[model samples]
Target chain A: MNHKDKQIQSAVQRALGDKGLSRRDFLRLSGGGALLAGAATSGLLYPGTARAVSTNARIVIVGAGAAGLSCATRLNRELEGAQITLIDRREDHYYQPGLTLVATGVWNTAKTLDSNRRYVPSGVNWIHDMVAEYDPDNNRVITDDGRTVEYDYLMVTTGLQVNYDQVEGMSEELIGQRGVGCVYDKPELAERTWRAVDEFVDNGGVGLFTRPRGDIKCAGAPLKVTMLTESRMKERGTRDKAEMHYLPPGASLFSQPDADDFLSKNFPERGIQIHWDHPLTAIDPDAKTATFDTPLGDETLDYDFIHVVPPMSAPDSLRESELAAQEAPFKGWLEVDRHTLQHNRYANVFGAGDINGVPIGKTAASVKSQVPVAVENMIQAIQGRENSASYDGYTSCPLITELGKAILVEFDYDLKMKPSFPVISPYEEHWVPWVMKDRLLLAAYRAMLRGRI
Target chain B: MAFSFVGILAVVLEFFRGWFWLLIPLIVLDLVLLGLFFKRTSGRRRKFSLPFKASIGFGVFTFVMALITLPGITRSSWEMLAGAVDYLSLIGASVGFGVLFAILAFPVMLHMLGIGPKHKPESQATRQSPAPETETGAEAEPSTASQQPQG
Candidate 1:
């Protein structure tokens, strides 16, 4: 190995504490790097051979996000002679859940953004293109560049598309104005949001945070921003100077009962006014005002700062496909049986994470529970055995009520409370949960996403 | 006969004890109450609109089948379902209780608060479309050029 490689290995060994590059880890890193380099250089691994010896059955995965990468990792481990290809439009993969912390100045933007190629498991092919058409009948998907790839199995994890156009008189251009920002969009924009918040504080203006209607990736993120922003202002001694408003489309602070009580009671003390059942309808950037459709009536509020959480929906590729038209409520967010995490139509196909149409809250914690279930079911199906493994619909929401206190709400399939650690009660906000949120969750998230867990 | 068989098995499991007598009447009362609830509620119609209706139907079907085929299955199934109901009711009671406490504790009436104004939709027709390209190879920028300030 080269000197630089030696240094990296040494550092990794030190970091991992005597694990000393397991055979699995070495193969994964080297194979993944070689495949990426090969793809970039020659478009194919071997010049003369049509297919590599390592790849037998072709597996296609849509989206290079958390779910797609996790699925690819599991498939690589389970199916040894399998050709896996992951396709995504973007060059960078983002840790989307961290955007909440980024908006509140708790995390830097660079921490959340990483190269998409860094996470793809070894022996998997990377196709950097948006899917143009999904023809499930023939078991093939066409790319925007007119390249058609046939696959024995297809896993769709495109998650959600941000619909910024839904708000009247609001365009993408309106962002980063006077004090306008959104944590739900691009992770890179989060730093700019912090700057906007800082400016809002300096200018003695009202900070308005909004939550739009429909299914967002992390439902608690908007409130996270609200609480963190309030805490930041208190630290800055600007709490009394600037007003804060949290406008949400939902009737309550949180979908979980325990979380809702904590937020409703504690938020008022922080001088945060919550406009429940109020959804952002329009934004007058020039006038520095935002209009919302409240349950009572329509209201336009003047604000120095505006942070919008855009309405999200299933990815267009999945929505337009024939698989989506099958018996389901929404489009084909992968028609996986909730328990088995296996596609109802095609047994080979499986899904995990936010893309699944389960009623559970879409969070990183939800993906942690889903990965094991998907892997178990996928392995069983591959071995021609009965797939008895089931997902419990487990999800967690760490509601950061303040800088030092958080209410960790965990629940299962039936919305039954499932706390990870025994606390006084699941509803009570405590400092230990907050510490877990700030310190341990990142390590857990990285490990879980890498499928080490 | 299936119900009697399951009931008899329950009686057997209870050691043919007098406690089994109480269970029989309770089971009958539960079945009667469930039937009454279904009959009185508008949700009994087969033309259900919600997505959860199918799952509910499947759960009920499984319960009925288990009760008919095996007494043990019926007892276990009933216990599990009852446990789920108990948990759900506890959460519901907590929320309901909290709401009641909030209402009673707060002096200000909820109805007294003034309603906020409504949001009006803008006219889309008058909104300017993208500008046409110029001959000088310069793209004409929009009239309202609001550049985002760099951090």
Candidate 2:
């Protein structure tokens, strides 16, 4: 044997011995790795691949975000000879899921930043401009740069926009200043939020985490930021010094009943107070006070640190367009059937991601499930056949309770717990879910974008 | 998917698919190293046990995965001295990742290392050995295939 080979063998032997990793352990690990690869390949991890259909249909996808890119990849792969164009002005793709981690100082800012160019498949046209107007009636979209692109089929994946202006006296510029933090999609903003959280953790005082009235993407993020901040306070031996308040717009803490039940009790036990029906009306960043419009009356509370989650809705382009739902409940959102994800009025139009007026599932996990159904339904429409796939509004949230623990909350439109791994209870906190969130989810998300399950 | 063993196993497998880029390469490297080790020690030992080889590969993988995931589990300085949550998370994540990756890499390792049944051409077998094949390498081959290697 060569000296180098002998040395490597010797080092490996020493490591095994030091760790007391027996032959059984090795056998188990090897068998386990083999099982994982086998299971993943055998269509157990996700659904099986279907044969690609051929079509010359012009498909224009709005917004190159998670849902848009995923739809592009899926549609590009599934349909042959199709003209697929993705429209979005933003070049930098943000992993919105990791923003919560970054805001909590658990992840670096760079981890959430990626390029859309990397995910946009070849043979697909990418328009480097945002859609200024969605004219579904004419089956055409006008870009911000004055380009009108007509499509045989339209997929609206323009994710919801945070309205910082909704809260009077509050703006995106105010974040990271005067102890105001907003954990949204921006990595820089998340980092700035982390700086504010860090200062709040060290010098503790009244920390208020606010949730707006309307539906927001990743509803768990605000609660997660609150819990994590409190955890950080406890870790820093400053838990007693901080007075944490979670002001939700409604009585329920979460959408799912079991999750809501668990969180409703969990927050109070953590000593973080909850004020129901208190929607954030305004925030005076200079005065360090937040105004909440409560059922009783308008109440202003002073704060040392505030996590501002703005009221969200479909982008102005989509909302102002004729495509938006004019009805009650889902008004100002993309008007699409919740199950089929196809437009109610326009058969050529489909919606996925947060823009859909679904009762639940404004999450990346929902995108994972919704994109396929939407793409399949679009393909079915192009084939002049009935829709074959339907979305159950499946969404997952790795609700981080602390740095080390989280709850794997998975549910559908019915708000019932559909735990993927039945062994891990959906209500209890566990490290497995936390690890999935911190280390593994980005890979899964990227895989989704590539349409590889 | 119901709550069956296979379903749970699949979930665990899907979880590790995210880390496949890093893991596949790691497993391949380990297999290459092990192949070299087996090649060097082949003559001395009567048989290089597959279980032992698998153990060595898995050990290395688990150690590396633990190292990679540990920093995240204990990223905060306060988490170091805070309580049992950080340490417990480290242990759980290490074991979970280790097992999942090991399961995913074992088949890959077996395929790359050619540890299972292999076919050798009759002409090559005749050229390499004069007498009937009696070595460990010969035993690893299919008996039926050995009789008619070319076929």
Candidate 3:
């Protein structure tokens, strides 16, 4: 081609670029990419204006999980002369968000196990014991060892408990045996689940992935496990021999409406059966069966491999205490103003992480967003001021549809989509979202754990 | 996950256990091909050079495949070399994916939106070469006409 042809081609390219991507679209996409990239790489979008508030107040944060550690880190750094104590017996902090990756064979179990000592901050006191009782009335909490620790302000970041016994004939020991798998607990449990998943993938058979009724941490994990198992089967050329069933506890596969609709349509297309409103009530591992409490009646399904997600709730101690909500729906959950994250009746008490009674987002991402609110409000309380920071119930799920594609579904209290990337369509499966999940989100999660984001 | 140095190391090792190993050669070969093509094409350029275009097209494909293997590079980085290997790997893989988008994906996308070039316009391409930057449009038109008789 001569120079004239090159000129025409250049003109055509320019025209195409100019018309196809207008300045507005270009700027929006560029800006969104920059924000996500910034959040992913530098951990700069922390959304907090931290200033050390000098006080002699006693600050107690329960649990040493993501939320607890984050709050403790922020409080320890931003408060002066404050006696900050974090109470939790856990030494190894399990990165719960990565459990799905471990179970799906993408990540090793070691990837999930982290030492809590690394994140507990220097100035804060670490109480290696569980809070057996929360006595907000007396402004004190009793530890399992019978120590009554008083606090000027209490942060209940105890996370939640997995009720494996709620599913009849199921126990923690049953995982990795009899084709039973549960990814909600420890790193070992997720690794054990992988053993069952690996065998099922090799020897093609009935694979049942079930989610229980009510809230669960990292709600998208069950879906990811199912999809990744399917991906593995496809990769191994065993998809033809295996049958997969996803038993979500409700009519919708996910809480976000668009994501729910997408999953509803996408699941059947991939030959995975969706049993609507079929919450897993029990599983007899020895018999290789799962019983679901359908709206019509009890329905039993035979499975060679099953991923069990048990019903979750705030620990019994908190639920039985005054801190829990006494009303309907959010009963047994930490009763707090959803926006302020402060205890409804007690201003000194606050809730973070999975224990909070927020409508959605019991995720690491939620903890990242909520910790700022809870910390800011607690600081405000220390300053004898009204709560200023508010949590918007922000939750994000990188909903992986395949090994290489995902839809990043992010939303708030209203369930309206709030996409960080303007170019990546929230409704469609794309590699960028998958990259975000497989690579970048973990970095962001780590950053958030350190209170950097 | 932990995102600690050890956990990152495990993730990188975890990648090698899968098909990620195949992407290594695909990407190495792609870069080599791209490097040679660009070296030859740097002096003058046109819309189509079969070798350069094909290199870019396959380079895009290999680059995308390499990109999918990014979790390995992203998770773990060496501090000894001051992240030299880490950054180079990331930049190389990302650029490959970027080229695929710019050349192949954009054209198809633009065409779908009815903005991409469709006409061949043989007259424009086969006629005398475009005038230099110094020449005005008015002068170029008459020069083309006058040169037609001379040629």
Each prediction's TM-score against the native?
A: 0.64, 0.77, 0.71
For model 2, residues A40-114, the per-residue Cα lDDT tens digits are 577554444444788899999999999999898888878888899999989999999999989989889988899
- Model 2's alpha-carbon lDDT is 0.83
Docking class of 2: incorrect
Error of 1 at A361 (Å): 2.7
lDDT per residue as tens, model 3, A1-453: 999999997886687597897656767888998976664433332323354789999999999999999898788778889999999998998888888888988889877788898777887899999999988889999999999999999999999999998999889999999999998879899999999999999997899999999889999999999998998898789999999999988888888888988888888999999988899988887789999999899999999999999999889999999999998779999999999999999999998989998899899878988998999999999999988998888888888777766787889999988776555568776655666677666666666666766
- Model 3 spans with C-alpha error above 4 angstroms: A1-51, B1-93, B96-151
By DockQ, rank the candidates, best first.
2, 3, 1
Looking at model 1, residue B26 earns an lDDT score of: 58
Which lDDT tens digits does candidate 2 get at residues B7-93?
444445655775679977877887776666466544433233454467457956896668565755445332322335445656665
Sorted on TM-score, best first, the list reads: 2, 3, 1
Residues A1-453, candidate 1: write the lDDT tens digits.
999999998787776557666657877988998976664334321111232133366788888777777777667766768778888878887878778777777778876787677667667788889888888778899999999989877777776778888887766666666677877767767777777776776666788889887677888888888887887777688888888888889788777776777788777777888888889998888898899998778899998889887777777777767655354464545577888888777777777777787776578887777877876676666567788888888888878766666677888777777876653247765554564566556555554455544
DockQ in order? 0.01, 0.10, 0.05
lDDT of 1 by residue, B1-151 (tens): 0113322332233232324477566556556644553454332222112222333444445444433433122111122222332334334434544443333322221112211122122343134443355432122333342222223
Q: Which window of 10 residues has the lowest lDDT sum in candidate 2 chain A?
A: A42-51
The Cα error of candidate 1 at residue A128, in Å, is 1.8
The CA-based lDDT of model 3 is what?
A: 0.79
Best by DockQ: 2
